[model samples]
Structure formats: C-alpha cells, structure tokens
Target: MTDARPLAFELPPLRAISVAIPLFILAVLLQPSVSARTSRRLRLALLVPTAVLGWISPFRWRIEPVEFAITANFRWGIFSPYFLMLAVWFGAMGESERKNELAWLGFDGKAEKKALGVEEGSTGHSTATKEDGNAGLRPRANGTLLAPKPRPVSPLASPALSLVSNSSLNDQLPTPSPSPPVDPVQPPSVVDAPPSSVNVPTLTSRKNATRSYSQRHHPLRILLDAAHLLSAMRMIGYAGGPRARDLPPAPKNDKTFFRDRLLAFYNAHLVSSACLALQVLDRDGILASYLSYILPHDAAVFVSATLARLCIGVSLWVQMKIGFNGFAILFYLLHRGTNAFLDTLQAILPRRWSEELTWRSRFDVREYPALFDNPFSKMGEGGVTKFWSARWHFLFRATFTSLGYKPTLALSKRLGVPKRVAQLLGAFVVFTLSAWMHWQALVSARYNLHPSPAGLAFAAAHSIPLTSIYPPPSTSLSFLDRNGTFVFFLLQPVAVFLESLWVALTRKRVSGWAGKVWTALWVVVLGQAVVGKSWLALGLVHGLPPLHLWSWHRFVLPTCSLAPMPVFMR
Candidate 1:
C-alpha cells in the first residue's frame, strides 16, 4: 500500500483555495450583518467555481486507487457540493428565520421575540434595498409616501417556507394580498404568509428541529448542527418527499443508553457480516461465476451485463448500509465511553463541581435518532418517485435538490413554464446532477486504477456488442464502458416521467405489484446498460476491504472445520 503510485499528474495548487472559498461563503452566511440577498448572490456566483475547484483538487492529491476512491469521492466530489448546497439553503432562508438564529438552532424563542417587541416583517430589509434604496418609495404627485411596494415574492421561497413552516396541515390556499395597513408599531404575523405546498418542520418545532435545543448557544454546537442539516438525510428538520410519510415514527425519547448500545452492536454485526460476504463473493470471482451460471446460455452480452449490474447494485446497497451502521456503532460507543468517564468523574468530585460540569457531560442516547429508516418497508408502493424518495437512501437528496432540483424549479416557474413541465424539468435536472456526481466518481476511480495499455485496449475492444459468459476474462469485462455509469443514473428521471405519463393516460398511479415490476425493469434490467463494465474495470468487484473471516476461523478457532477459500486481493 505504501508503494502504490499516485493517481494524478501533480499536486493541485488551488485545492486549499477551493476549500477556503466554501468556508468563507459559510462565514458570510453566518454573519448577522450580511443581508440575505447579498449572501445569496455571493453563493450563487461562487457555486460553479467551487464545484470546478472541488472537482480538480482531488485529482491533484497523491493516493492509491482505494484511498483515492474513499477520500476524494467524499471530500471533493460529494461533500464540496453538499456544503455549497447548504450555503445556498441558508442564503435562501426567510427574513424571519435569518433574524432568529436560535429558531434554526431549535430554540422556541417565539415568546422571547414577542416579549422583546420584535414583530415578524418589522425588521430586516428586502432584496430591493440596493436597487430601491428608498424602501420602494417613489415620489407621488401629492408627495405623500406610497405604501412600500409589495416586493414580488420569490419562487425560490417555496422550499424555504416548506423548511420553516410549523405545520403541514395548514390550508393550502395561495397567499392573499396584503390587507389594509396595520399600526406602524405592529405587523401581521408570519402565519399570515402563504402555506408551503410541501409539508416540513418549523424552526421552532424542537422535537423535529434540525438541531438539539440544549446548549445551542455554544459555537461548537452550532457547527455540529450545521453539519447535521447539511446532510439532512432523514430530512429530520426539513421538508421531505412523499416517501417521508412512509418512514417509521421517530424513536421515542424514552430510549435508554443500554438500548442504544444494543442497537450499535446489532449494526456492527451487520457491517461485519456484509464485509465477510463481500469478501467471499469477490474471492476467486465466486459472485461473477454465480452470475454467469445463472444467466441464460443465449443471453446477449448486454443482457448478461444488465443482470450482473443488479449484483453490483446489491453490493452497493450493502456497502451503504455498512457505512451508515458502522458510523452509528462508533457514535454509540463513543457516547457510552464518554458517559462512563463522566460518571466516574462525578463520583470522584464534589457535588458543586459536578453540578458546574453538567453542561459538558456526554449526550443522551435520546438525542440521536436512527440513522436510516427501513427503505424496503414500502418498496414500489408509490412508484419510481417513492423508490427514490422514500425507499432509497437519501444521503444525497439535499445536495441534489439544492444544487439541481430547486434552482430548475424556481427558474422554470419564473419563466412561466407550465407547472407539470416545470416539475419534469426539475426532476430531470436532479437526475442529471446525480449522473454527473457518479460519473465523476467512476472516472476518478478509473484514473486511480492506472489501467495498463493492454488492459485499456482490451476494455476498448470489448466495448462493442459481443457475448461469451458472465465472468469475463480477468473480470475486466468491457461490454459497457465508464459512461454507462452516467447513463444508468440519467435514465432515472425518464422512468419517473414515463410513470407520470401512464398516470396521465390511465388516471391511476403505477402501484402495487405492477409498480414492483416497473421498478425492477428500470433498475435491474433495462437501466443498467453498461454499468457493469465500469465497476469491473475499476476492480470494484472486491472493492471493500475484507474482514478475513475464513482466516480468523482457521487460526483462532482451529477446531472448527471449514473449507479453504481464495483470499480477496485487489
């Protein structure tokens, strides 16, 4: 591993610059003095450059294939855009939310604001401050000040409202025009604003708030909260898709540390088992051989690759679960150990000292929720939309939406595009971004592998239509190239639109068993195209580091009878 060659030509000089830019943008957002409009403009202006920098920076770093895949794919490819998306989300926040950071921190400070005579819409200038510095005031023929022009509401505000709105059950009526002027000292309540089309949690809804209410004033806590919202996988504090409705209710607050520990151990066991299974599958190409044997004798190369792609999909799903669960276990153990140490200290110290240190104590298990919902629980019940929204892991949803879907939707609305057409365009944009993200990962992984001239030639040679078997020579099958990875993701939105078309014509959704078949065909068979070649060429079949379960059994449990198996190798 130490001797492995670096993937890129040289170290990128602008990598640190790329990183600093986003942090700077975040800083601007956090600043109370910076107006929301300025922050938004700055963020929008910097997005492309930030993406370009992140994209290029990882390639400059010196690392082996495995290391590069793990480090660069996250730090640069995924997280860079993720952080930017968060910045955009923050920039797009409403004035009421911007004025009360505590609200975002999960503090229900509405009473406090009221006591301080801080009325909603009373503070904070609009985006028109720069252009119409006179507060939208223009000289009338009578020289009387005309009521400040009602600033045209932003279409982008839809998601922001969805995020901060307290209740989903509110009437879905379009916002009424401003009523006759109230007293100068008081303003209409924020509740008077139009309800968001999408249902999500309000900033004051502590139970579902993005951040924990306790210790929220602490800077470190704020940073942690920002990170939590950045990922927003479960959409715990924000608006979620239709699938969110299917999620099991949040874990009750009565959950104990012991229960959390058990949960952690359970997840750890799953991770271990997955790693072992993946190792077994990779060794001697057992999975490859199995797929080959199961495929029909007359199956074309495309058919074989498509079927094999399902295995890759399963492998990816397992890997995702492993990572999520592994992190959960680590967090649980850390909390357990910290609490144990805290208890020991409290027992040794005086009561006064312990009381003073209470705020510094470890987090309660109840503060953390389950990392994932059971995605399989309601599979195919809602069609492709539900599959991606409710059934699939939502780790990338926020990033995809903020960077892709939201902007397109907003722009489409602004352009007078029909509502349905706008939705389709927005969905397509989201998938396009997803496709680019995966393409970048695959391309980076390919570069790191440092394929030889012979291997490259062979890969190119097999790119065309040809058929032999599932487990091709050297497991570097090339019936599909790296571009297939992009194609697979790009087709997702097409599936969604097709489903919509079906509904439009048939007056019913594609659901039940029929929905299952539809999803399988798109995901397993027709959609995979050439993705298998990309993974196989990257030597990703045995991508994960194995646990060496067989070796452990042979050496540690010598009395146990087990057959010898091929060891996994890169």
Candidate 2:
C-alpha cells in the first residue's frame, strides 16, 4: 500500500493585486475630496497600474484556473476606475478651461469669476507690462493728466507717465508750496468699462477667424463646448437652481437645447472612448480588429449597445432615487462589469490594433464612400462625392489627417467646390446616419423584447416632451426610468435632426421656421420622456416580480423560486 500525499502548488506572484489595492484604496479615500482638477490626476495615476499590470512579465504563470482567471479579470476590473478617472478628469479639465473662457466672454457672474481667480473687469489681461521703460505709468481716474509735462513724447510712450511729478524742476521750484495747503477735492467716482469690451488676444481667432468661427460653430464643437460648460457649472455648485446671468447662453429654442445637451453628453463619452481605442491600438496589433471592424459594421448595433449602457446606467440611478435599492445595485454592478471588461480589453490590446479598430469601427466605405479607395475620383462626381471634396471637407479632413489617420480618401486632391459647402454636407450625412441608427435600435429593442410596452411607451411619451421643456429634468428622468429605453427613442431622432439643421444652416440651405420646427420636435420628444409614464413604470416594475417567474428563476435569476397560485374548485 502506498502512502497518500497531498499535492503542493506554488502561488503566483500578486504584483498586480498588490499594486492595485493601494491605488484603489487611495482613490476611494480621495473620491470625496476629488475636485475636478484632482480627480483628473487620480485618474491618470490609476492608469499606472493598468499600464504596469498590462506589461507585467510572466503573465503566463499558471495557477488554479479560477484564481488565475479572477486575477486576469481583476486586471481588467482596474480599468473601470482607470477610464472613469480619466473621463472625469478630462471632463473637469476641459470644463475648468471652458468656464474660465466663458467668464472671460462675460457669461459668468462675480462669484464664478472669483472662484476661477478671474478678476472682475480684467478681460483676461496680464498686469505685467513690457519693459519699454513705461513701468510707473498709471491711467488717471478722469482720463486727465495730474500735471502738464514740458515735452510730449510719442503717444505710445504716454503710458509711461506717472501720477507723481518726477521732474527735478518740481523739486527745485517748490518755494510757493508753504503758502497754503488746499484740501484735495474728492475725485469723481469713475466706473470702469466692462471686461467684454476689452479685446483679448486668442490664437484661434488670430490664426484664421473665418476657420475658427466655422470650427467653433461645428455641431461637434458646440457639443464639446456644452459638455465643458455643464461640467464647469456642476463643479461650481451651480448645477441646479435659478438661472445665473454669467452662465453660457442657454439654448434659445427648448428643443435645440435638449438635443444639443444630449449630443454633447454623448460626444464627451465618445472622446473618452476614443482615448481607450488609441491606447488599445498602441498595445495589441491584430486582436483589436474585433472592436474596429465587427462591432462598427452594423452602426445600429454600435449605437444601440452604447446607448443601452448609458440608458441602463441612468435608469439604475433613477431606481435608486425612487427607493428601488435592489434593482439599482444590480443594474449598477452589471453596467460597471461590462464597462470594465471593454475598457480592460482596450487597454491590454496593442496600439496599432486599437487604431485600426477605431478607424474601422467609426468609418466604413459603405457609409462614408469618400473614405474609400477610388481610381477615378474628380470634381462633381456626385452630391455625396462633391460634399466630400469641398473646402470644409478638406479642412475637416486635414484636421483628422493631422491626428494621424485619413478619415476620407482623395483628400489630397482639391475639388472645385467651396470648402464650407462640402463640410456642411458631410456633417449632415454623419449626424443623420448616427441618429437614424440609434433610433432604429431603441425602437426595435423596446417594442420587440420589452415585457411592458405600455409602461415604456407611456413613460417615453411624457418624459420625452418634458425633457425638452425642462432639460435638467431629463437627467433625473433618465435616472428614474431605468434602462432609458423610452428616453432613447425620443432623443435620438431629435439629435439627428438638430445636427442636420446645424449643417444646413451653416451652408445657407435652410433657416427660420424650418429650423424652429426641427428644433421644436427635439424639445417635444425630450419633454415627453421627462414627464412620461416611464417614471411611473420604474416604481411599478420594481414592485412587481418577473412576468414569467418560473422561467426567470430557471434561467435569469436562478437563486429565486416562484410562488404558485392556489386553484379554487367550484
């Protein structure tokens, strides 16, 4: 008989976990104290572990499958905080700059200016003077000189004039000073000019004012700017309450405002996602193709998945607000888990793969033919081709080209059409495609699969319209209406229309009531979502059990057993 012996296994090194724990703890501790600025820094810091663990030697070391898998998963899990930190950080940084700029533009009030270290009436000017030997000069209260000078220098040199008489002649010829000391008359109160009137030098304006204005007016630019503005407002504790005069101009048309805000929110998220793509492409070379090609192949799938995540997150928050604790936590965990997985995969992949993936995912030959390889490309091929070859197209093309990827092919060849016209057409096409895809996905998913169509439709009908009328309420409504299926249907088309209108307006294609009608639709949709039955359904769904509890228990929630109804015999 052989003696039985237990097998001994060597444990894998816990370097990744060791590194992650301290940082995780630090981030948790710092969360409450994380101002917009610090939050960004913390996010950057979190990336250190992601980068380090991703590059750790001997990642192939074998342990128990469960333990190894958990560790590998944990490495990915860290990316949630990593990407989230970066998103919040980037948002905060951009917002801080935007608020400062807006305040400089005369949109923010005294308190905001003070909080940003912006002097009232300062006009972004530096107090430091150039050393042209005019250091002591100070402008007088009434725009008059204190004393007449013997010789007048150049008008430019007048800035050097001092309040006190500095000439030796005044010191020598002071014999009459003892006669009498007249009381100095009180100087008339001089009101300073408003800062908005002061011209501040800007690189964007100086380089090319027309281009700058056009770029700033671009729908994407407007959306990013709005995101920054909203972030700044939230940071300054002015997220809610009465309208502040210093805030950036609120959307004049309710529908336009709602649509713009939604777009801006989505764009901000995309930008962060783009960053992840860039990181992944830099790491994994070929595997990133799944993200770049397969996912983006069907625009509807991409939009639906992205929007669904957002809606679910918002819905979870809403459930939490309305006292549905269990559902909220479950939703939050699922969302976080999925987000973490995606973020980690991106981080772990090679940079080349990631870039290729991003390019393939965002643009396709079918949708964006201009980006395709064409042998006989020239001027006036078609409306779409003409639009792609315009001057604005070249400018936008150049912008993306400079970023190291050519979004459109044949950008090197100059088309006869004006740049702005082409750009407007391109922008319209892009927005329309994105919006339509999103709308189709939401409608199909909600109507086909949802157990409670009436509840969802009712919620959407009210919330959509209400959000347009009152934009702030949209955010809350989204949170309360878990899954945001209703909200998505209402908002997506509005966003598409707004983008199209913005492009048309840019190209002088349409204006006035036409614009207003398009804008109004967005407002109505948003309003319906905010005040709709969806809000009510959130409470109802949480209170009730799954429609087919036995089936749900067998598959969806295996931990729970269904209660059976008793039968009555007549």
Candidate 3:
C-alpha cells in the first residue's frame, strides 16, 4: 500500500468494470425473459466462474508479493465488479432459479420447506389454498414454510403444533378456531346485534355508556367484544389479510429497462468494487493471501440503502482527491450499494430475485427493527445483538444462519459442549466460517493460503471481544465497549448474558439506548479505521480535495484532474 502523496493522476483499473457490470446486469434482466430452468443455469454459469476467479489471491503473505494463476493480477481483475457483481447476480436470482439449482442437485425444491413445518395459506385469509390439499395450519410466530396437515377439530390442539394457553379462561369458552377471515378493524355495525332471548348486559343509559372507562371506540376492540358475545357465531365471516412473507414469483416479462440496471449497478457496485480491485490487479500467487474484508459481505441490505448516492459521492470524492484507488471505500460501503443495486433490480426484475435477502420491515421499527435504527440517516441504536442480528444488514442472514448457526448447534451437541459454551464457541465458528467463505472466492490457489491476516483480524476482533461479554462490562470505557460489543456481536454472550444478570441483580432492564449509543459510536470510529489504511492500500487517498461538485461539473462544466490542496496551490 502506498502512502497518500501527490502524484500524476492514474486512470485506475476500472477496465474490467465495463465488462463485468454489463455482463451482470444483462444476466439479471435476461433472467425473467427466459424459462426458470434456463435462468437458473445462466445465473450459476455466470456465478461459478466469477467466484472462482475472485478469491485468486495476488499477494504472497506478509511479504506483499503479487503472483498469479490466470492473470498477472487475477485477484484485482476478478474483484473489479467481477466477483462482487457475480455474488450479486447469484443473490438476485429469484426463487425459481434457486429451486432449479436445488433440482439440479437432486433435491425436491419445496420438500425441505414442507419438512420444516412451513406451510402457506394457513390463515383464513388464505383459505383459497385449502383446495390444494393443504388446509388448517397457521403460521408460527417465526414464519417458515409448512406441509399439509389436518384441521384441528378441537381448535386448540393439533398434531402439527401444540398450543399452551396462558389463560385457563379460554378453556371455559369454546376454542377460538379459524374462522372465515374477518377484518378485526371493521365497524361494530358489521357484526350482528345480540339476540333478545340471550341474557346480556347493557349500559343502563347513554351517559353511563359515554362515561364508561372501557368504552369501545376503536373498531378492532369493538369487534373483539362483539365476537366474544357472538362466540358461537365462530366469527365465521369472509374477509382477507395479506400474509407478509408470501412474496410472489418474479414477473415472467420483467420490465426492468436496460439502462437502469446498467447505471444502478455501475454507480453502486461497479464504482467501489472496481476501485477496490486495483490494489492487487497486477499481483500473482495464491499461497500468501486471499479473502475479502472485516465485517461479512451482506446480502440483506437496503433496509438502510436510501443513502446509496451519498455513499457513492463520498467514495468518488475520496478517490479523485487522493488520486489513489478507492478500493478501501468498498470495504466501508459496498454492501449498502450492492443492496441498493439489488433493490433497484428487484423493483423491475421479480419478487423471486429478492427473496434471498432480508430487510427491516415497516412494522415495529423501533422495538423490533431491522439492522438500522433509522435507514435515512444510516444511524443505528447499536448493541451487539442488535447490530449483528437485527440492525446490521442481513444480506447474508439466511446463508450465514444455515451455514453457521444450525451446524454449530448440531456440532456442539455431538461434541457434548454445554449449550452456553456452544453458543459462545458457535459465534467464533460463524465468524471463522465467514472468513473461509471469503476465501472461497479464489479461482485457483494452493492449500497453504489459509487465514489471511485480514480475515483473522476480522474474526479475532470479534472473538476476543466476545470473551469479555460475560462478567457484565465494567465502568471502564473499553469494558463498556466490550459489553456492548458482546451483546451486539462485535464482542457476545457477555453483553447478552448480562441482560439476565441485570434483571436478576436490579430487577430492571439495562438501558438499551446506552448500548445503542456505544455501538453507533464504535461503528463510526471503526468505520474510519477500517477504511483509512485500505484507502491508502487501494491508492484512493493520495492527498487532494474530494470532487463533491460532480453534479455541477458534469452538466455545467468538466472538472479538470483532481483539485489540489491549499499547500499544493501555494
């Protein structure tokens, strides 16, 4: 890595981006235009080669020598929107393509989902699906696909899932069974009046009714009361509510304009990914170094991706001014841009394309929000758990959970590790697996190329912090950071474990906001650190004022080479 210094402006190695990005976009847009089977084949055909090439390390160990298998600087060339875009391509391929991939591997696509108890259309709103030989199952709180099952005749009990009611009062009343989907929010008039023969309580007078503390003004609450009175009616009326998870397949003729996919991916992934690829573009050898960055590359992005343009602007400015490569900036921001790119494609591509990713929902954002505390500002109410699980982009959530979370639990049981120890060790394993996946990007490499410092640094950074999560952080700032890190995932079970300890010790919850604030601060601080040297490595920070005036320059005038500093001007 070169230190930031004034030098002749280099064109930088963006040549591959032109080909890689266009190829990526062309593949995605064309996906829906073809049959699902062909689409899947095309995506994997594009992805496999790109991935194999991406991990071909150019550098040889701490020695900093560039070697090559396919090209002089194979790694950088692959990274130039090549590997990144391919990953994006694989990710954006809709569910149809995904299922096709599974079929090729000889697995029935939906068979596993059925095995997992993830049946669809169980709600009365989706009763139309009952005719498909799947009837009378409800979505669990943790939405997964289900298989066909018999209706619960008792309404409260089923072979599929057991219901443990908190209140015994429910036992006295008839079981609240599935009724024709009704809008709980509908007006009381939508419900029938109680029968005259049935003994019923009524307000003695209008004044009493008006003054009653429990007056039913809200439509839904009123509907609930009506249903209780009409309990025998079974609330069996027709209505509908859309299940949030049942995303539709991609449009057969997706209308994503040719130019939009090109421009969107270029600005987001191409720009930074291309920039990052420059450092090792000319190196050779795979035995020394391989892998990507610190925090995992996210697939679950765009829950906070409104800032795509802002991140892009910052990156370009940093690049033009420094006259170095902008690769390091990719480390800080590519996930957001890639996510934004996918979001753009999804809008025009198909729903299946985006099902691979997860994001923040519009509902209960504060209490049960996605990775971001607020997407617009890129602000997060960070805590370790929140950052890792809910707040940070979940681009790789489904992937990571499958590869790391479940397998770790299974392995732990086999090894007879305690559940508590397993969880702690499992986190390390997950981070380590993240490292290995980064390595999997190599097109050609030797076995000795293991544990690149960059990946080790990433894994160890989190792993060490994790050990301190227990003992409930101390008053020291480092300890506090540790506690918060452990909770959110930067550090572990310590901060998360402290939740129980705090409640036990003080009978009150810890101030979540404090941890959030610390997490946010750490993000800002660590972000600068993570990107700083890498910028130097990528040559993006060779001392010059940033080109923040691109919009003005583009339409009004063409800016010259990177703007010089006051010292240089003097």
Please name the candidate that would achieve the greatest lDDT relative to the true structure: 1
Please write out the lDDT profile of model 1 over residues 435-461, one tens digit for every residue. 666656545533444333433343245
The candidate, 1 or 3, that scores higher on TM-score is 1
**Candidate 2 lDDT (Cα, 0 to 1):** 0.28
- Candidate 3's C-alpha runs over 4 A off are 1-50, 56-131, 137-382, 429-512, 525-540, 543-570
Per-residue CA lDDT of model 2 for 1-570, tens digit only, reads: 432332222334675345444334333322212344565665556555543543332233322121212212222332333333323333333322222223212222232223223344554432323432222222223211112232545644322222112221111100000001111110001001111211111211222232333333444333333333222211211111111221133455434533544444344344433322222222222223445576554663444334323343233222222222232234334545655665666678998654322211111011111111121222122122222222011112211221112122124225554433333333333333323333332222222122133333433553422211111222354553544434544344334344444445665432345544543334333433442234322221121112221233322221111111100101
lDDT at position 122, candidate 2: 55
How high a TM-score does candidate 3 get? 0.34
TM-score of 2: 0.23
lDDT, candidate 1, at 540: 44
Predicted structure with the largest TM-score when compared to the true one:
1
**Superposition TM-score, candidate 1 onto the true structure:** 0.59
CA RMSD (A), model 2: 25.1
Better of 1 and 3 by lDDT: 1
TM-score of each: 0.59, 0.23, 0.34
**How many Å off is the CA of 335 in candidate 3?**
23
Q: Order of all candidates by lDDT, from best down to worst?
A: 1, 3, 2
lDDT of 1 at 205: 30
lDDT of 3 by residue, 1-570 (tens): 533332232222444234444344333333222345665556656665554443332222211111111111222332332244344445345542222111110011132224223545444222324333233433333432223332355644322122111221111111111111212111111111111110001101111233323232323333332232221111111011011111111112212322322233334434443332232221111111222232222421211121222232244433322221122223224435655765776677667755433331111111111112232142332244334433333223333434455467668978999765565555555544433332322222222323234333432543422111111112322432322222223333344444434445766533455655645444444433333222222222122222221223222221222222211121
Worst 10 residues of 3 by lDDT: 195-204
